[model samples]
Target: MTVQFTPDRLAHRDDPEVSKITAISLSGTNTERVMHIVVDLLDELGPQTPAELEHVYRSRAAVNDWPVVAFYSVHKRVSQMKKHIGIVAGTGVREGGAERVQLTTDPLKAHGKITAHMQGGDE
Candidate 1:
C-alpha cells in the first residue's frame, strides 16, 4: 500500500527522538516481536503522539524482550512494522507541534488473539 503523510507530519516525525524510539522497537531482527509491541502499544494508548507513545512503550514491563537499541529509531521501526505486519500508519499534525501515529488496521484482527493471549492481555 502507498504510505501517506502530510509534509508537516513528515517533518515532525523526522525528529531525532521519534526516529530513535522507532529504531529500538524494531530491533532484534524479529518481525513478529516488533509487530507485537507496536500493536500492544496501540492497544494501550489507542492513539498517541509519537513522543508519548514512545515513552510508554520503552518503559513498559512487557517489553523486557524488546531490544534496547530499537527505542532509538522509531522511523525505521515504523517502516519495518508496516512491511511485516500489514499495519498501515499515518501521521497527523496536532496542536502545539505534535505528531500522532495510529494504526490503520482493526485492533482485534491486528492483535492475533493467539499470540496476544500468550502475552497475557497485552492485546
Candidate 2:
C-alpha cells in the first residue's frame, strides 16, 4: 500500500532516520557526514523499516569513528528534517504494534533539502 504523510502526524514523530538525514543534509558543514551515513544505510537495505534503520545506526556507529551522541543526534535531526520537508511516509505503528517507515516517493527529488528553508543544490 502507498503510505501517506501529513503535518499533524509528523508533529510528534518517533522515527529518527528521516529527521537525522534531513537535518544533516541541511547542515552546511555536515552534509558529507550525513550523506555518508545515509548512503551506507540506503545501500545496505535499499529502504528500511524503522527498527532496521535503528540497527543500521548502531552498527554503523560501531564501525565508524563516531560518538554515540553524534550517531543518535544525527538520527533525530534527520527525522525532524524529514517531517519539515513532508517527505516522511507511514505511521509509527502497525496493527501488530510494529513500526513502519520508508523513504518517500521520489526520494531523490524530495531529499534535495531538509526543508524549504534553503533552495540550492542537492546534497
**Candidate number achieving the greatest lDDT relative to the actual structure:** 1
Q: Could you give candidate 2's per-residue lDDT for residues 1-123 as a string of tens digits?
A: 222333223324454555534443344334334433553465456655545665667677767864443434444434554555445455565533544554554545544544232333344
Taking all chains together, the TM-score of candidate 2 against the true structure is 0.46
Error (Å) of candidate 2 at residue 63 is 3.3
Error of 2 at 59 (Å): 0.6
**Candidate 2: deviation at residue 90, Å?**
1.3
RMSD of each: 9.8, 9.5
Give the Å error, residue 61, model 2. Answer: 2.9
In model 2, the runs with Cα more than 4 Å from the true position are: 1-28, 39-47, 62-75, 91-98, 115-123
**Steric overlap count per candidate:** 16, 10
**Which number leads on TM-score?**
1
User: What TM-score does structure 1 among the candidates reach?
Assistant: 0.49
Report the poorest 10 consecutive residues by lDDT, candidate 1.
2-11
